[model samples]
Target: MKTQSRWIGFIAIGMLVLMTVAPAFGAGRPETTATEQVTLRYSWWGGESRHNAFLDVLDMFMEEHPHIRVEAEYGGFSGYRDRLSAQMAANNQPDVFMSGHLPPWDILPWDARKDLSQFDLDLSYYDDTLMATFYAPDGFLIGVPQAGGVGGSYLINATLLDELGLELPSMFWTWDDFAELAQSVYDASGGTVYGALDEAGGVPYANAGPPHFDISYHNTTITNENGLALTADQLRFTYEWWGRLRESGAVSPADITAQADDGANSPIVNRDVAMLPIAMGSFSRFQDNTPDTLVLFPAPAGPNEPFTFGPGMSYQISAHTAHPQEAALLIAFLTNRRETGIRMGTEVGVPASGMYRDLLIEQGLSEAEEAMFELQNWIIANRDVRGDITVHARYNEFRDLVRAEQQAMAFGRQTIDQTVDAVVRHARNLGMNVR
Candidate 1:
């Protein structure tokens, strides 16, 4: 009777073990506890600061929404478009990506891959101008701008300025005032520094940098309804004026048309240049690179009264994104949220949404950035932000040609009229229908 009872117990135990282990071995592994993870891939081009800031923001985004995972890719500013084109050719584009609208290789065809109308997106959180950059002519907000990259005052070595016993205006300075400042600095430096280290080529056709100030100064852009900037004459005036700076010895001798050797090692970094119009985000970089305290302000005096500081660079979405709606939501959250927006730093443009901008001012920004914020607000309120307009298919080529002319003009090698005509001619030759 004892042995029979023991045998019965053993059989019961074995049966329970089989029931627990059998399902895992049979019929596709018992559904293996499904994982609720959604992965997205995002890419952009920027610096170490930008990359790190972006990673942090994305990490924050992920933490809030544990169901989502993001894979990020970035590189230095140079050769950014090449990577995008190569990746797209491999059909291995990230689920979502960031880009500017120009760079023919990216713009002309990249625009086709997206299908925003079909995507479930929300744009109510973003501002209208910020929405316009990516939208199709009919209407499709391609991406949300990370911020507006506006420029104002140069990082003047106040020690350098005040040491010279010169005083700036109480209110924001105009272009004429800026020229005087540059002149004063140059004179005071006794030729140790040039007033403004002309960044004629900095505003890349491939990328939007502060170099746009030249065109913006003249009330023209690379593209307009009238024609290419050079052809438009109004824009050409600035390039010609740039030539005069060289003639008057207010600028540098380096060829503006060539590659800009900008970094901690450049003349601007050495304080050999009196003025440099770097983005507000990287104002710290200028400080880090220079030997003095740096100050920030608005792009000096608009040629036509006060000027609306236009959107600098934006973080846009791919129209072909399989998860367009989700991507848009991510951007909206990043831009509209006060905390997330401030965490973004100056890596992207200044937050377009006023809500985010307030947070930034409340957080990391230095006195320079705050001062700039105030100046920009004043400009936005007083000047027309929409005063400038952009319209062109071959924007990259157009800007490049203008930059090339700036080089020539700054070097005093070309007449203003000749520079303008040359740029216009090249655009026409490239089959650009610049009106």
Candidate 2:
């Protein structure tokens, strides 16, 4: 009887020890309904409409998770950098933040910005192409594409195309094909209208402004620090192709060059043009602005293949966040197309997630959305990326200079070769390579 009592006492002591240790270790027990509430703060820069959409998603996440709480903050583009810098300095950056490639200004590297990498955020979901940029030279997956979104898809006025009996284009189209179709649309609409709108806004806007987020002069090469993985001759051909389009009137200076920064806010909404080149994910905003049904097609490829692409935005967890795991969870949730039905092309861009592209098709997007989804899927799977010029600190300044040279070429002040030479000289003079 005494022995039994001692064993019971020993067991009680063990249980007590475990109970004591459990609280210290956060416990091996399942989280209770009464566990501490986790609140994560997320901030991004976008228009009010974008804020609304993201909030809706956040709400949906909260509903699904039940225990987690989210605080969202968003604002316009102006002063975003200054505000974020302040946040970083204070070690109070949002749990998750919107990241893009407009660098020198951007504090990426996640370590510097306090980003998280060990979320085991399944890389298999994102297409290999989409994952490349998020990883730096050492292969730290600091961020992930919010939607693996594709940009540069031509958003055509479906009603205009219907009126003209021209079908909205297929997912894959080469530049030559684009020119032919634009010419046809031009002939049908006459000199009074044209087939497509350009992202090129007017001068000083045209001469010295930044290109759309996806428009890039070059991308970082993990292979080499100074030189890019792509050829300068290829980049030259890309510029030459743009020049040809500009010169041939397949794409005119008027539509593309109308809004320096407000590229979407211009004539396209007023129905002044038939097609506007924009990011696939941003189509929702453009669609909301106009009465026309907008369909997406891949960016016009070159004579050989479509170029590579980079992210318009990336979802990065702040290193400073108290809830790194929770923050990464939210990012993973947004990026995982299978969960939200967003990557399926309607909510975000086409699938950059290899595991998730089919899920997008499964979500039953509209015909217009479907085609765009397929195009981006192809790009992601195939690695046809235009990449970015984010590596060079002066890429932006150089790009603005290049834009001026291109505008001069378009305005007939400088010939294509002359402009190219000037651009090469300028880039080389800036301690860069210009083949």
Instruction: Kindly list the per-residue Cα lDDT of model 1 for residues 123-144, writing each as its tens digit.
Output: 5655565455455565654455
> Which model scores highest in lDDT?
2
Assess each prediction's global lDDT (C-alpha) against the native.
Answer: 0.59, 0.59
Query: What ranges in model 2 sit over 4 Å off?
Result: 1-40, 56-71, 77-92, 101-107, 113-115, 120-129, 165-170, 198-248, 254-256, 260-264, 310-312, 329-371, 381-390, 413-418, 425-430
Q: TM-score for all predictions?
A: 0.73, 0.68
Tens digits of lDDT, candidate 2, 266-293: 4456555676566566666677676777
lDDT of 2 at 272: 56
Best by TM-score: 1
